[model samples]
Target: MSPERFARINQMLDNRQIDLTVCLDKVHKTNNIAAVIRSADCVGIHQIHAVWPDIDMRVSGNTASGSQQWVKTIKHYRFEEAEQAFNAQNMQILTTTFSDTAVDYRDIDYTKPTAIVMGNERDGTSPEAIAAASQHILIPMIGMVQSLNVSVAAALVMYEAQRQRQLANMYGTRKLDHAYCQTMLFEQGHPVYAKACRRKQIPYPSIDEQGQIVASTEWWQRMRAPDPQALTC
Candidate 1:
């Protein structure tokens, strides 16, 4: 990669919010999903969880504007699976819903490990999702519409989290651990080589300061060899 491109990637990785993420529950609209991914990228969120049991989690490239390529999206067939994964990471689930117990979205502590859950375009948040949430938050609406589109709402909530995190100096330095940063940098900068290493069941080669792979020719030859276990099969 060019020095400028490498520097840009390094800067983005440095500012990535590892503790913050967004979860979509059955959000099927392509445009909305694309918009959410775009907003997530803009806010420096590295990961996004999607739970759509009945439909494939597909977003439009046009609407996503290449933002989807930067964000890591994990798809779950069920809400329970997604919830468990986030819980395992010690992240607090904050669901957006219209309920008596729901508070303003800005009231929560975004500087902490958080996963904001957004619901479907039509039904809002599901009961199970709401029940699973650690907190219920909503964007106040005084106009007749009462609610905004899922994408718009997600952008609002994500930017609010960004704003809070910024004030806390979370964006001033690298938050992601060294191992994850290295892995992500290598994967993003040399995706084809990384995928080849995965296929060969070998560890990824180290990357230089300029994002160039720093592996010996012998190592490359070894990595190209068929896996012994697969050969036995």
Candidate 2:
């Protein structure tokens, strides 16, 4: 709640890049969910729409860390709750499955508003959830195992989303649109950070209007005024 803490929250929000959301469809294992959260943050995603019928955190552990401080994780009591949330935002959902219509993960157009639904560790997304998905994606494998750990699969696909968004200059000219950036900035860190930045006279991280971190800030406004109350925590 202190300005210092608020500023740090803002910093995390500024750095988030992917607009991708990960849906842990009935993911019961805490470790898997936690690991996925860590992975989501690693790739700069700021929002995670998870279907946690029972929001258990012991398994996720530090994997979620202070991410919720920066990442605005939306919780859905039902799988459909998760679906409606994203669909309302016009974000297309991408599910990991081997349906006849499945596309290679690499082929998905990550630049668009996107969400990925990762089903249970034991059983993948339910047929109902998949039916609601905007599209289906699958990671090709040479081994007998059809998929990697949910966290690993997320990392692979998310990076590609980052890559495609980059190609589109999601940071340069196109930039993260204002809505996504601001929502991320607001969630990643504390809301008070914005006031802290103004008080500290610091150049808040290089954020697009939407609050997404600009990959390169050579052209951004450079300022680093210390928080007036930096001496106080």
Candidate 3:
């Protein structure tokens, strides 16, 4: 990897918000999903959770654009599963829903560990999701339209979270694990060798501070070996 590229990736990794994320409840549209993920990457969100009951609704690579390389989309078959995972993380779940008690999205304290939940394009947030949320939030719209598009709503909420966190100086330090950072550096910086390791079922070698791969002679031999399964095919 070039020094410039390595430096850029390191800068991004340094600002990642390990405590903040988004959860999609049956958001089936590929375009909307892509837009949300793109926005998430722009705001330094490392990953987003998605509840996809229908297998066909998965995001396509074309729709995801280049942001897919940086942001991870974690899939879940059920809302309950996503909810349990979020709860275990101790993140305050904020659902985008309109209710008597629902507050303006800007009013919430986003500096805390937060997971903003956006629902499907058609039905909006599921009742179970709303019930599980620590608070219901909505973007105030004065026009005839009662709600914004799912992706638009998600971007709005995520930016608010980013704004609050930024003001509190949350973006200054590195929050991700050291091992995770090294893995990302290798995969993104030296993508060819990273793919080679996967193809040959060889474990990844450690990366040094100068963006160089550090591997033993045995590991190198394994990486250079042809894949038996690929040869047969």
Candidate 4:
């Protein structure tokens, strides 16, 4: 990796928000899925949760615009499973819905660990999601169209969180796990070698401050050796 590229990756990693995330509740549209991910990436979200009961539903690579490379998506087959995962992370789940108890999206304190749950394009949030949410949020719309697109609503909510976090000086610092940061640095800074290591079933090597690989001679020999399974390909 060049020094400039390494610096850029380090800067991005430093700004990553480990505690902020989004949850999709049965959002089946490919465009919407991709848009949400792209927006999440722009706002420094490291990961997002998605519930896909229908296995056929997936994000379109073309629509994702390479955002998937930076923003990881964790798939869940059930709503309850996603909820449990959020609870384990100690995130306050906020569902976007219109109810008597629902408050403005801007009212919540985004400085804390938060997970905003968005519903499907048509049916809106599921009953279980609404019931499980720690708080319900709504974006006030005075116009005739009382609703906005799912992705649009999510972007608004995410930006609100970002704005609050920025005011609190939450950016420009590394909050991700040390091991995870090292793995990302290696995979992103030296993608070619990372791919080779995976295909050859070799463990990743440590990267030095100068962005050079630091591995033993034995490891180098294994890396240069021909793949025993190459003939199968």
What local distance difference test score does each model get?
0.88, 0.70, 0.90, 0.92
Worst 10 residues of 4 by lDDT: 54-63
The TM-scores, one per candidate, come to 0.86, 0.68, 0.95, 0.96
lDDT for 88 in candidate 3 is 86
User: Which run of 10 residues does model 3 get worst, by summed lDDT?
Assistant: 55-64
User: What is the per-residue lDDT of model 1 for residues 1-233, given as tens digits with 9 covering 90 to 100?
Assistant: 66877888899988889889999998989999999999999999988999978655679999999988788889988889989988888999999998899999989999889999999988888888899999999999989997999999999999999999889989958877777777877887878777777877778777777788788898889777877768889
| lDDT digits (tens) for residues 74-98 of candidate 3 | 8888888988888888999999898
Pairs of colliding residues, candidate 4: none
Best by lDDT: 4
Off-target runs (Cα >4 Å) in candidate 4 are: none
TM-score of 3: 0.95
Output candidate 2 Cα RMSD. Answer: 9.0
Residues 1-233, candidate 4, lDDT per residue (tens digit)?
99999998889899999999999999988899999999999999999999888666678888789899889999988989989988998999999999999999999999989999999989999998999999999999999997899999999999999999999999999998878877888999989889989999999998887877899999999999998679577
Clashes of 3: 0
Best-to-worst order by TM-score is 4, 3, 1, 2
Using lDDT as the measure, name the better of candidate 1 and candidate 3: 3
Q: Which predicted model would earn the best TM-score? A: 4
**Global Cα lDDT for candidate 2:** 0.70
**Per-residue lDDT of candidate 2, residues 1-233 (tens digit):** 34564565455545565556788788777777777777777667767877877655344557777555545567788988887888787889898888999999998888888888888888888997889878889999999877798878877887888788767866433235566555445434434655555575544454454434454343233223444476586
